[model samples]
Target: MAWKKDDLFLFLFIFIIVSLYPCHGNFSQANNKQPNFRNASSFSTMPNSPYDYIVVGGGTAGCPLAATLSKNFRVLLLERGGSPYGNNNISRLENFHQTLAYSTPTSPVQRFLSTDGVFNHRARVLGGNTCINAGFYSRAEPSFVRNAGWDEVLVNESYQWVEDKIVFLKPAAPWQSAVKDGLLEVGVTPFNGYTYQHINGTKFGGSIFDNNGFRHTAADLLAAGNPPNLQVFIHAPVQKIVFDTRGTKPKAIGVIFNDENGNQHEAFIKTDEKSEVILTAGAIGTPQLLLLSGVGPKEDLQKLNITVILNNEHVGKDMADNPSNNILIITPEPQNQTLLQVVGITTKGFYVETSSGFGINNDSIVTVKNGNMSELKEIFRGGTILEKIIGPLSKGNLSLVNTNVTSNPTVTFNYFAEPEDLRRCVAGVSLLLEIAKTRPVKELMGNLSYTDEMLLNMSLNANINLIPKSGNETKSLPEFCKKSVTTLWHYHGGCIVGKVVDRDYKVIGVGNLRVGDSSWFDVSPGTNPQATVMMFGRMMGVKMIRERLSAG
Candidate 1:
């Protein structure tokens, strides 16, 4: 094997080229043109030119939808937050909590405690919640999507486009293995090997976290976007959708927005007939924007002084949050790190999952169940069994805090307000406790908190309301769950499919306007909805492309 001079030179040149690259070719190829992703000011000074499509809120759904739409159309994506690129807290798996704890008003994640005291954060950045969530990725159930009146073929096939761009297989570590074993031991049943499909019984799923522990999100999906067709303006929040009513009914013609500097600007639709304003803003932002733009319930808009364009009663009603409770198990030693790898999908109306290597530093702060901040205790270093119960009967609503776009929309998840919801929580906690008692998990788990009186009654705050009766309150699992149940941030169905948007994702009464996001759910999917949100984004992208071709 003699090396020729030309061959040696060629190898050296390619080696040098890769070495000069920032990520050693580890990231998506489209990421090399990162200059295309920029602050809002870049577009703010440009002369007025209407986009073929305008997507508001460059979060989970918005990014993918806009990126896909930009393939042939001139798409303008307005993101309220900065780029997720180069942010350590967002990219690293270890800083999962750090991103959430970044509580500054301008932080990418907008931390808020709901009226019921459940802690949650909304993504203020480009990838949306995908940039800050637990990074679990699972496809929506086929049955669920079919019932939503989606094109069954498109819905099933579109997930690969998203999975290819961002989703990764989470390798099960010791903790995850134990979790899988524990779930199987407790008869969660029918072990399906590692899969992306939403299946019943126990399984291992994918995540957005790469093997190197870097996050790949909707931002990465932009890598596939045609740079010239796509223009993303970060730190620019859409204030309201502007409508033109000279025709049969009002159509969203443009939008009013503010740059990072708080300077106001306007952008409009250009591709006539097909020109559209899509709200990929999440549950909160999507409904909030629609309501603010005078397309909500009649009485609510009148009270807020917003001129009603459409009297649709279903804009922001039927809001539901995926209720989740964390059961922490103290390990004899620091367990291996992993995301939601092993999970139990039970017929009992709940799903059990595990999170390891949360890796919070001792000095890092934690927001308690009561919304008070305190230095994180050492006990949080262990593994966690995070359980989310489906089909909660407790649905809440969101409306205008005021006409001000910047004002946070008044929100209430209304967690556990329904007796059925409380019952599900009790059942979920009991199942997890049963799993914890299994030999595999028992070796590592210790101490589930509950009050004896509360356990006997299976009621929350009934006999044990602020009484602090003895017998190690921390041992009562039911009480701890009741006091500390939080949202998985898997909120959906705000602008529901049937009531708000049709199967094509078009808003019922509005012209040239569509809503595609987690909020479009007829009912929330059983798994983490990031994959589903991305699926909707992908579907909208495909639909728009098909419509354009047909019109031509």
Candidate 2:
């Protein structure tokens, strides 16, 4: 078997040339140019061709699900918004927060807006709301995850698996440290060693993870590996879900959507095969899509002149959101000093008090570390019952006011509806005020007065006045509470787990349909939701792959 040096060189050269050959004819040409589609809207034009899996909504969940499923199955991802990969406005972290206001008109980040006109938050871009999110990546509380009805083993395994993939970065800069220390002085505690945790607690410190290093998004995550079987269609709005009822089990055959040019087209599922159709279109879009396709409450559909396929009353009920109110205190003399500046300038802020409470019986309330007592007192006297209680208790529903899928759905969150909800909020605010007066924090507050004088000015002027209060104030606490109410933008729980989708995320009454987004959360995590959403998306993806493989 011994060969000469020339013979070995010739063999290697021939092997390299053969390996470079394309599997199909003209593969090299196709790789160099775009597909033969007439336009960007042509993806929906092909109604006869079927796909192995049709995922609606290429958002946080849809994008990840499509990317993962494409490893073994052909996936068709439909996105209502344009791509965010190279979009300048969405690519940068600083620009992301600014785009929140315009997400609904053009992006995929739009959720339900509050009726009081205080909070208008959502994203409508290709990356979903993550495009304009605060970008805090922390895991959910263990108790909260268990509440979703999933097994403990499954929940922990899912959390670890997702965290490894996303890999959130801790705050390493000094400015972040300053903010964290300031928050600590005011009684905000870190929860679960992560940013987003607890259903109703104040989070002082949060970790800043570069969402894909400025491109942190589902689109980027999925597009990076570039699997051959995956195809993503942007700016394609799913108009309807066509169902095949001939078989014993109802099957979603395909979807019909509209393109940027107002042209309609249908994308049929591949024939003779049962392809699972997942609806990761998010809380509002998914329900709206279902209702439009005649798969919602029977009476509601009849009113709209659409035939009902499934009468699921829980489709849009139980809407929940974290309504936040800020309690800004004037530091004695701008604690933004050298040490604080160094903390903020050098490293990401440190997270204090990761886990404080222990559950009594797994479901019962557990007493945890009480954050800064002085700050709690300030919040109590300054904030109102409406801000504390009713804001937390009120639940809203999403309904289709119009048939247009692109049109914004009517999202009404009856914030501050219940008296008890208001009462709880008042208690929480009272606690915050107490924390502000503590020695460690009070020492930092020099000459600045906490009174109703500054509140009156900010409420009247409609501007964020961070200035310290004057030493004089005769107005009562009740007076300031009435005029200085604000709202938080952390919305959650519209399509809750068990209430909307089953434990497996499969729609209760529908076949071949699933939801994996913030809407699936049983309750709001009382903190930033970016991390929680990513975890849920990851869990759903893993479960989906396992289920498909088992069936095959």
Candidate 3:
């Protein structure tokens, strides 16, 4: 996704403007508080003890995976970032943009600009992207589960497990309610009210935020686990997976990681041959670690001077991200702060979602008199209607920036690189444009008269002019898509299934090593992968527990 000048300005207004405020909000769910039995500690305080399972990365899937495994085995969960317990920016709905904007050397949100020149982020907190996302929680399509080789019954069970602890049925705010009505008004189909199911048509999905506007992250899922058996260490980053190469099949036995103070420690697995070292370090982090551990393409490892453990060519290939395009609807009326709750799922290969506030002060306004945009005092009161291309076919790759595990690897998603993907974007954007003109949505804007002709012509008073100038609407639409495309932050691939990992999520050609995160996804499950990813953690853990018990 390429960033345009206007997109940059819009992003800045949303993220950077209000970053100066300190985070402040209480967690609504009591489970969101770290439990007494959760042996969570900073890395310096952690002892180098052997564990039955060592799970690197305490983010979305990792936290739940580790928690579930602890039911019958000793588990150690290592996170590169601190806890999200008291971070108001991460927990409060109103501070959404500020949390993403408050980037620092050790901040929970790690900022990275892709090689394609589009800014992206990686979550460094215990809850992973759950700490920074818009909090929209929707399940994977049933077809997606079957295609991914997951048990359909188990998938539902796992989803219910996570929902019981964290997911909430969000009450639709006025703007979201209007947007839902607008989606129906535009033929998005029969409304599925307040559902977690990913289905066609308009519906209000689940959210991690409670009615009090406080977020409950995946970390809260740990409360369901046998806590006495789980040890969670924050600010502990694994440098590489230590392999025992003496056996016929190279086996992952331990991990070498560094503490917050830069002290190295080694954690090994117990004597049980089934013990494993799992990487739930997210899509980018998992692949990067594989490459750094000399588990990727041999030539790449040779250049990095890392000893080859396993030369897997598919480790960092086929990276994909959902290409997103959004238009800020600057309403004259004061709209309440909102995150993505109401979603419009289209049969046309994309999804539509709306959000009202991103921490932008409503009093602030931007006046543009340059080029195609008219001189209108656009207030940031109204939210944005974002279109995400479903199942983006355009793919790319991820490679090492350096040997440093913490540094972001170079990635290119090649958004709209596929002609089919471009077609989808055009279709999705056209639908979004129509939705904006619907009576229900327009009524919320309070007479912000904007017709298709005015919007396409880039009229000053049209209130939607993010597209670049072109002679015709068709030519301009594609150009707008290419330049204005941004990430929904739903990027996945890297260590995809069949190629990098097997159906069981175990790393190919290696023993006792597995990846259990979005990195295992060949296709992003639904509009949001968080729900499925959390479910995956639970399902896999349950499977492992059953396998272990059955063996005995």
Candidate 4:
């Protein structure tokens, strides 16, 4: 079969039309629960400045941590980005692609290209990555908790606290239903049904998107806490952590940040000995801030002319991004837009997921949001079968791009850098090809015919396909794994546990400073890390409260 120029033109026309009109199902009336967020530009001076706890980066973890701590202590949560409330792009599931397509200075997502030639985006909004990510929620594997040396009972309680406020349980949509059946057909596993617990089986996980198609982000968790004790400031990027060197060992006393207006402000800890400064600045921001504040490798700091405080060589090391590869299929009929819902957790070390009904226009050329025009790719439309390896063995390091804390650091996940990673990816792709032949998936694909040109052009659009006109699927798999590899945006590490931070999450040599986010994870938790990251915030907050009371 060959696609003529006329056929290609007709397909493009349909794609543009379908993209304009997104599927808007029944909209259920729901209450909007958010905190009273003030612009950092509003106040040049801090009101009741000295606080018991200062939580930087009011993201997926920061919001919950600050909210929980405020119940017993005065907490100030600083966010470099604006609030997610009232933003239609952030609130609606249908506008997911549009939100990512956004490329303004104040966009909810900030794009960055890894030195390894992979493009990725980091959340730049108060809700953190939850505002920009596919809203799948699942708890960490019990093994992850045990390995991290966390209290199992408290871990479950913290997970419940986060679920109660923000998580919603729902059945899969039409396309997702087909994917679920396809996975089962391919013998991915016994069906586990709806559960948030991470297990090796095909199951329906929890969603941050409710039944009404509204996305609930971590910022909403703030409403559950004591509001009087919590003060949230948006558009306030911390330049660095302020330290007092007069002590026998350097102590974190406060933080210096700039408002949206570029006005500098300093916030200090309260007189309480238990008061501390916490960093929830995600994987990248956490490490970048530490390095900028003269707390990284001595040689790197000396190169950058930064004063050396603690010569911890592991501050920005062991950065890992889950290597993701997928195949895109053009459906015969327009499908309803879906985010990640049903997932296939294979016995092997990879997870499978799917998303459908996202249409892209001719003008929608994708580029890194960091003003790099040379690296451009096309956004593919229609349904996709995506797989990402769990616990990628390969790792890389992050270094300073510049002294500016807002600028993205240079990072490379070195995807497939380890032989084990490639092996798992090849296995995952083999299973996906098998799943595509399943009855349920074939039915969803319909009588659609694609020519060699169509398949080749699809890859140009940054979508991978193992199926060829005629070739050995086995041999082509390794090449496909390398060429098609991209980020799942599930990156973690840098300020990792046991290396940079202790089991209690305190920076090894730094006093009164703690990290409580995915940055502390040695392994990316579960298939989706948001649930675990949110749970961690609540867990740490509870621990801090207990520690303070007992210490007194």
* Model 1 spans with C-alpha error above 4 angstroms: 1-35, 360-376, 445-481
lDDT of 2 by residue, 142-174 (tens): 666667656667656755544544434443332
The global C-alpha lDDT for each of the candidates, from Candidate 1 onward, is: 0.72, 0.50, 0.78, 0.78
Q: Write the per-residue lDDT of candidate 1 for residues 1-552, one digit (tens) a residue.
A: 686754443332211111110101234433533436767777766655998999998887888788888888898989988887788888877765566654686887776556665455678988898888767777777787768767878887788787766677756788888889999998888899788887888998887777777777777777778888888888988889999988888898999988888888899997477889999889888999999999989999999789999999988888888677655554445565566777788877778887665453343332333221132243344466757877667788887878887667777777777777777777888776676667877666444333333222222211111223444434566556566555667776678877898877888988999987878764567567778888888887988899789989
Better of 2 and 4 by lDDT: 4
Could you say which candidate leads in TM-score? 3
Q: Is 2 or 3 the stronger prediction by lDDT?
A: 3
Worst 10 residues of 3 by lDDT: 16-25
How many collisions per candidate?
7, 60, 0, 0
TM per prediction? 0.86, 0.71, 0.91, 0.88
Give the range where candidate 1 is weakest over 10 consecutive residues by summed lDDT: 15-24
User: lDDT per residue, candidate 4, 404-521, as tens digits?
Assistant: 9989999988889899999999899878777767788778767754442333234324432222323322247777777666667789999987889888899888888999888877
Better of 1 and 4 by lDDT: 4
List the candidates ranked by TM-score, beginning with the highest.
Answer: 3, 4, 1, 2
Tens digits of per-residue lDDT for model 3, 15-41 = 422221111123455535574322233
